[model samples]
Target: MILSAPSKSADAPIPSFDQIPCPILVTDSAGVVQSLNQDLLLLIGSDKERWLTKSMELMFPMASRIFLHTHVWPMIFRDGQVREIRLQLLDSGGNSLPVFVNCQKTSQEGIDRFTWVLFVTIERSRFEQALLESRQRTENISTALTKSEAFIRGVFEATSEGIMVTDSDATIISVNPAFAKLTGYSQEEVIGQNARILKSDRHDADFFLATFEILQKNKIWNGEVWSQRKDGSIFLGQLSISAICDQNDVVLQYVVLCSDITERWDREQLIHQMALHDGLTGLPNRTLLMERLGQIIAKSQRDSRQIALMFLDLDGFKKVNDTLGHSIGDEVLKTVATRLSSLLRNTDTVARLGGDEFVLLLDNPENSEAMAQIGARVISIMNEPMQFDNAEAHIGVSIGIAVFKDRTSSPEALLKRADEAMYAAKAAGKNVYRFAE
Candidate 1:
């Protein structure tokens, strides 16, 4: 049999082809019309007789006619098939349709051995509307994603505190500029390197192990720590580390949040110093002196050691203040404080108990001789000349010493005895030291 089927007029082999939904037409080898589908009649907005009055090219423009006669028919004849051909079809409304057309040729026994047919995949009317909708949706999604990326980048760059991201091995993956400036490390020097490069050597290996163990177990850790900079300056910081993880809780990387507390800590220390010591003389005030003396008495009671308590008043201090103005007298007091500090051993406490009255905590004294020598040393240092404001000033200390054999719960009683001896020294002589009975 010839490789052809019956035409639409004689009931074609494919039933769906007979009820073709798209515009279809068949013609013989010489191009006379043999059959047409209902779609073809409706598409041209004309019935069979109207189409028969014109050649197929009369239905198309001149350029499309040349394309159909030259390229389209030869390819179908060579391949015995045409698939999904995209082309423009002219409608009776004089509007063009963007469409995909498919055609096939088969031999018919009585019709010059060939049948040519055409199909329209898309309706000529609604094609532009569908394409416009598709393009609009694509544009909306692209714009939204672009805005989201810009917002995220701005937030990452604008944060105040230092932030760092590191991998599982503690190698830094990304660090913001604040982190670089805080640690004195450049981005190039830090990236792809272990963050432990900033390790202050303050934390030992055990400390690291404990820290990571907590992070692994709890997924987070927050506390204070000592860390060093690239230049080896040690500083304190409040640090927090959180481990980033996958869905199964396998550690991916770490995010470190840190704040430099060094300046705050220094301020706290200055406040503490101001509260415990006199400002101008840099000598322990009574509050701190009493605390030290109490501890010393408690320790001496436990160890059966003797402790000395001395009260000293600067002689002729009021004369200096009255003659040279109170400012020069304050300078002389500071000079005397410094001299006493250099002469006293580290085991003792020297305090300025307001004005020119001072107290000394003599720790671990042996006997009356040890007390006498300690007493003599302090008096000699105080008797030396002190220079203040380019002028010579001389002063003497009348000191009274008392030994505490056990924990003296009564600071009042100790002070009373020391004061009594101090008055006795003033009465006995101006530059002498005496011990309390």
Candidate 2:
């Protein structure tokens, strides 16, 4: 039978098998004795060597041995465990000892083993009858407790989310099967290791300090954590940690649960990118362009430096769309975006404001001459023919320059000035540039 001991306080240490308060025996599947705990050894009045490698039949009287062969072994083989069987054992002096036996079968390292817990019964026949009656009354409650414990153990083993239990000092005590699978580390490998072995070095000391501080204050912490596996791959985990405390509110252990969230995180980032970028050209949209312009303006004002904003309207794009269809026109726009992005410095910003309208924010351009040179380069590149499928398309761009020198100018006002200048450039000619008045 699988039995759960009494619930221990959080601060209490787990007792060793030999330190247990009851007599316990362990044997292989064939009833060959493997080990006996101290209490069992004392009850039998024998040393460890006497029982080692011996068949359990040697410890029992003839009647009990027959009962074990006929009833107990069959029950254990059929049910994997048995509870509350009355049995008689032989002590060193050849006296019969009556006991209540509970046994469970378990597999470890591919070998089946049986563990037995024995409770001594009173020798008087009247007392034994009374004790059996009392046991019958509590049997239902005991069975319920055992089933509940077994159900909990089943869940722990079967859950997909990783679970780990550690002492207050962050020493790993136990890890569930999911934890082993997720980390690529077996239970035996991580049992005594510090939990930091999973650290990915992505978070700083301050990050952990803040996490613990919040956990201390609230008794629980939940957040995203990046951890490394035994194979050295990093995974993002949505993690929660709870402190187990004693009656005096002293922490003794920590329970950590985690689920991999890397895919969810990547999806969120994709959604955010879609929100701020153009669908067609993958360039910054108007909203992102304006936000970047505002930041650059603020920085330029603080440093007493000049910044430039260029407005571009494609010259023959509508004609190409009208004749060659929107697909080829889209190809031409994407090609233009790539060329424009390649020509600019990494610090400069190039954005598409929908349709054939584009904008550029240049940080601390040396002078209007340098701005004109960039505008000329843009016009020259846009004039080149773009090949798409079996057709070729030609497009040109009219450019307008707006210089930001006054700290008082806002992003909207600067954009308006550049827009007006773009109209001026279109009025002068289709493929030329103009400065804002």
Candidate 3:
């Protein structure tokens, strides 16, 4: 009996090889193509009849053919399978098309055959380029952030002014090296402490409350502040406080910048004192004396009170200067100033108007009799002998008095009136007092 091969059942479906998504080919071990799917025909834009029985190298570019001989064939023969080998094929339009080729060795009817699956790799190349670009951008951002942080830290550490950062609650969060040096407090001592730890008793509660109110409204405050160091010494500092805020306008932190200005403040005060006071006796000079007299005059007029002005010229002062030198004369004058100051009340002012000339302002002296008594006492004190450096000096004073009531006279007018009265007293015998006519 003769047996026939089983025929495919009409009811069962046969899967078409052309329906595979990837281009596929069947080849012999000699690299000649035996069959190819319709997908392969579309990929190369050619008909299957033209590719059948043709060497696979005929479809590849020169470089791809060489790579196939050197790498793909040897790997496939050694391992019976090769995967992910990239190559280019020439299409009907003569354009080079990149593809990933995977091959597996198989047997059909006891003859060795190779199956090749090729995938177009255009989208994958584009995705890989985009991934590389994204990675580079991320690296660049990280590097920039690092550099910015380093620059800020350098400024904080290197600045001469103290820098302190605190939270919204005024708890110290961080301090720079300059802050530690200025305050004499280490970072370990100040961190987590209230900012008030550095407060000196110089400012009251209202001062801090007002400062905080200004900061809340304007977001910054600048002023001079007295702060105590860890060693309990107080220093004046020019301080600036700034509020750091978030996107929602909520206060996140407070930055305090401060520099010690104690030396500068002291120097300024010294300059002011030198400008307004006499260099010899450290007493108020003519400028300050006149300013004070003006204020007193205004007050006396408002209160309907009386003020006394006395101008005195020292007698025998020039003889002392000629006999015992100007140094001894200066000592005698300083001694006379001390004795006169001792006799007056704290409210009174005595100023020297150059050599041997002095002015005294007495606030609300009782009557002309009281003014005469003060004038007599000044003359008695001046007549007493003053011993300086083992040299005895005798000097007397010629006193003139000018009294002012609630009048509209200017200070300059009252002063000139006193000057005229002084010359009248000098015309009268010296060492005597006379009242303004």
Best-to-worst ranking by TM-score: 3, 2, 1
Model 1 alpha-carbon drift over 4 Å, by segment: 1-152, 202-210, 213-217, 232-234, 247-249, 387-390, 408-417, 427-430
Q: lDDT of candidate 1?
A: 0.77
Best by TM-score: 3
Across residues 98-200, which tens digit of lDDT does each residue of candidate 2 receive?
A: 8888899998789899998888875554597888888987897899989999998898999999999999999999999999999999999999999999999
The superposed Cα distance between candidate 1 and the true structure at residue 113, in angstroms, equals 24
Rank candidates by lDDT, best first: 2, 3, 1
Per-residue lDDT for 75-169 in model 1, tens only?
77788656766566687797655556566566555444234344554554365667777778878878887898888667656676678899988
Q: Local error of candidate 2 at 190, Å?
A: 2.3
| Cα misplacement distance, residue 274 of candidate 1 (Å) | 2.3
